[model samples]
Target chain A: MSTTEAGGRIAIEVTVNGTRHRREVEPRLLLVQLLREDLRLTGTHIGCDTTYCGACTVIVDGEPVKSCTMLAVQADGAEILTVEGLARDGELHPLQRAFSENHGLQCGYCTPGMLMSAHALLARNPDPDRKQIRKGIQGNLCRCTGYHNIIAAIDAAAAAMREGK
Target chain B: MYPAPFRYHRAATVEEAIARLVEIGEGARALAGGQTLLVWLKMRFDEPTDLVDIGRLPGLRDIEQEAGRVRIGALATHARIARAPLARQIPIVGDCASGIADNQVRSRGTIGGSLAAGDPSCDWPVLLTTLDAEVHCRGPSGTRTLPADGFVQDLYATRLEHGELVTGVSFALPGKGSAGAYVGFKRCAPAFPTSSVGVQLTLNGDDCTEARIALGSAGLTTIRAKAAEAELRGRTLGAGVIAKAAAAAAAAAEPVADQRGSPAFKRSLIDALVKRGVEVARRRARGETVEVSHEYY
Candidate 1:
């Protein structure tokens, strides 16, 4: 039990948004901090930072996980997908477009978390009903919208995703 | 909310993990699923000198059937347990897994961690206690098994010794005509249950042949409502009988006043909750498939 500062820096290789980045980070560095600070992929927000809020939600090994609740070293050699990876070729993803069209966001603090959560839901269940949509994003707390439009956006996105729009 | 400095060691094997834990002694904590441990680290409430990352230890994530038992490896995530065929075969496990926090949390929270964390209000420890499951562990000495009831001693306390790793859990497969239900009341969907009841019983016609009743968020740890179970066993499950059993359970629990509810309120809630749990289990035991999913998970 040496009380030295986080032992020593360790090398880790993580593939984020289809690109691999290798860097040395402190053992205590959280995955969300690594994404936001070292890799500059700040889309993964850290609210509550204790995992009560899903603001730091990201896909690791094809599962949605709160990045704030994971160590950067734990994610070494793992593939991660953050909110920043939602769109491809400069076009907004269907969920992002649906959120905008349906007025799903107001203050936008929780939208990243909502988006990432909904993205994973749609990935697992492409056409979730309203009940399922609510269940899917229930972890992501949106203090602004009252969740009516967020639910509508996810519902609409489910339909569009099913229609291949 | 950044975690304080600590060395991390990813152990590829449980033996190596045990050795590292022994070397690091009390200063070492095993990192599994990183759901609860990471929270402690971020809050700086836990300052372990080293974390043995056992999240990827080989053969620790399988869910399979072994003879008359269903073996769920230590690393099996809640999501995996929820969707596993083994859980569906014993629906109570799936019901419990499906209602733990949310999908994201389920994807990260492991069954072993859930049981090892020993949260008094957590679904797995309480529900597994009712189902009479076993928790397997590996330490410097060797592998061992413990009943779920004794595995969790108190809130945030477990029977796990130093340098010990939970290898997996095995539960006796519920025999035919067996059914179970876990009913919980929460302020919000994602919130931990204020008063929850787990009832597993086997029915012969309308009579309860066997019964195991567990109540959570009602006391220090998940408690067995022995009086309640005794009231139901060998008795014909009528509305009156269920109500009496519910009352017995209410009288058996000792819920403290908390933000969730008042002591009296929780006791009253458990009365109705136990009734609902019994009714659902009765229905399932009668070969009725009742589809239920919580809003949060």
Candidate 2:
């Protein structure tokens, strides 16, 4: 939980998806590294290590944050959700299915971050308009310029989710 | 990108954080949301040996409205502030908070961290200066309050001492007949504004009784356009007078040429932003709902 002092390394516990993990980590470790390397949750891709690109976006304690800019030590005792946690029981989540149907991705480098961002947005506002959807995913940049399809997929997911599909 | 190795100390209280900073000397830095600090660390811009984790400091993330003033705790995230009831009551606060960076960054960036970073391009300093907010800081010695206008001494510098931390910021609520707007021009959601303006006007019918204008990304520090404010005070907010005030604000700015724009280009942006800010503030003062924010092209 809360650490006062621990020399070069510190003990941290975090709940990711539905699993709890405990590890002793160097404070310099980035959260992206924790997810991709330590936990082997490779679904969260790292595009620009800088904060500008939201390729490493994840939901931490209910809000979307850029994992590239967050330290693993900073995420102590928090709940995290990555792209790997989206599907359930071998069934694709509504957003994932919508993305497939709407041709929401091209190179797919930005898919995970876009999915998480759109998921957070839909969680807050189940019926975001086109402009709102655009604002919701503004942090995520797709190099393939597949934003049009991505927005449509988010819209489709919202509608399907609202109808209990 | 891995940050250089640093010892992490989680402070349980404000006094403890200050003590750790004091003990660790200049090599210690206080970490909050880490939206800016971590980026700097990753870039190897500044390598500190110790970090005081103040992210979980109690009673430092509260947003409370008291009597005639609103107080925002240092750890209040931009996302939280953007949706707070206070922001709805004060449109300028919402404009600044909601228009900063993007969703992911806003979800993690704190108002205090933005102010503490002392970046001229940061929106909180400009908006707080327009509201005449006071920064509350606690240090090893004692506590003090500083005006937001002069809090940032220069580029990436602040009045905060080695062992001091900002506890919160408070500003008197704008009285009736007063409203303000924060407007900026940026290339995209994540990019910093090329130039931004914050204008708070107290309008009595058509006559402007008082005006406060602060320019961001137009100088090394947030610049208070006193000459422009002088032009607006006690004058009818006619088109000609507003233009003159905008011109004065453009003249007051000292923007450096960077990838954002040329000096002349930024000056022109400052002029146009001031006018837009004034116009939106005027409309909002008249009880009309005007949605204004950083305009991106």
Candidate 3:
């Protein structure tokens, strides 16, 4: 067990939103911290800091995971997708557009996690029902209690995605 | 809420994992999905000096049927197990696997980690106990197997020693007319069940030839209610008989009052869950597609 100074840093290489990065991080540095603090990708919010809140949710190697509970070292050699990756070529993804059109966000604290989880869900299930959408985002919590609109947004996004939008 | 700094070691094989755990000594913890361990680490519940990452160990994630039994590798995530062909063959497996935590947690949480945590509220231990599963382990002494019925010895404690790691779990395939159900009640998807029941039965028409009843979140460890099971074995599963068995199961529970409910409340909840579980198992045994899971309010 080496101290932070004595143990030094472990090197890791990961791809985020189609970009690759190689950095040295402490063994205890959480994946969320690496994404937000080290990589300057502040779109991945940390709510609750515990695994329960799910605000730190991100897709790692095709699985939606609570980044707060995962160590940066554990995510080495993995591909990560965060909230910042939701847009392309300055155009909002269908999910983002649908969320705005459906009033899916209020205080916006839980929006990032909801978007990532929904993105993963839609990727796996191109057309999800209301029940499936609810189950998909059950890990994320919105303090504003605006889940109905979020579900609607996901539903709309699924429809658009199926139409090849 | 950051976990304290610790040395991290990634082991490519189970043998290497065991060796590193032993070398790192008592202050080392095996990291699986980190769905449970990382939470405790953040809370400073048990600060270990080293974490042996075993999440990427190959061959430990395989779930396959062999001969007369189904073997689930320790690293199989809950989400994977929930939709596996095995889960379709055994609906109880899907019921338990899909009802744990939420989608994100299920994607990372492993059956091995759930059982290793030894938490009474974890659904795997109770579900495995009902299926008469055997936990396989490997350590400095090579390998060994233990029955799931009493694998969890106490709260947050198990029969596992310092260097031992659960490699997998296997259970005999349920014969014809045999089925089981896991039923629980919780406040939300992420919350642990207040009280849950797993009921497995082999029935010939209305007569129950065999029964295994287990209660979770009802005691310090998952309780195998043999007395409750006796009330059903070799008996016609009438409403009256099921009520008696449910009552017996409830009486066997030693629930401690917490924010979930009072001890009396948990007993009543257990009784209801046992009845529901038995009914679901019976329906499934009759070739009915009945969906049962952790009811969230």
Q: Please tell me which predicted candidate would have the highest DockQ against the true structure.
A: 2
Clashing pairs in 3: none
User: What is the C-alpha local distance difference test score of candidate 1?
Assistant: 0.84
Please tell me the interface RMSD, in Å, for model 1: 4.2
Q: Lowest-lDDT window of 10 residues in candidate 2 chain A?
A: A1-10
Going through the candidates in order, what is the number of backbone clashes in each? 0, 0, 0
How would you encode candidate 1's per-residue C-alpha lDDT over B1-297 as one tens digit per residue?
Answer: 677678788887888889989988999999899887887787887888888888888899998887988888999999998988866666677778888777788888898898777778777788888989888999999988899876778768899999988888888888987899877777655577887888999998888989999988898888889999999999999989988899999999999988988989999988988888888888888888765433222
Decide which is better by TM-score, 1 or 2: 2
How well is each residue in B141-213 modelled by candidate 2, as lDDT tens digits? Answer: 8999999999999999999999899999999999999999999999988889999999999999879999999
- Candidate 3: misplaced stretches above 4 Å? A1-7
Candidate number achieving the greatest lDDT relative to the actual structure? 2
**TM-score winner between candidates 2 and 3:** 2
CA lDDT, every model vs. true structure: 0.84, 0.93, 0.92
Each candidate: chain B TM-score: 0.95, 0.99, 0.99
Ranking by TM-score: 2, 3, 1
Better of 2 and 3 by lDDT: 2
- Which interface RMSD values do the candidates have, in the order shown? 4.2, 2.6, 3.6
Off by over 4 Å in 1: A1-5, B293-297
What level of docking quality does candidate 2 show? medium
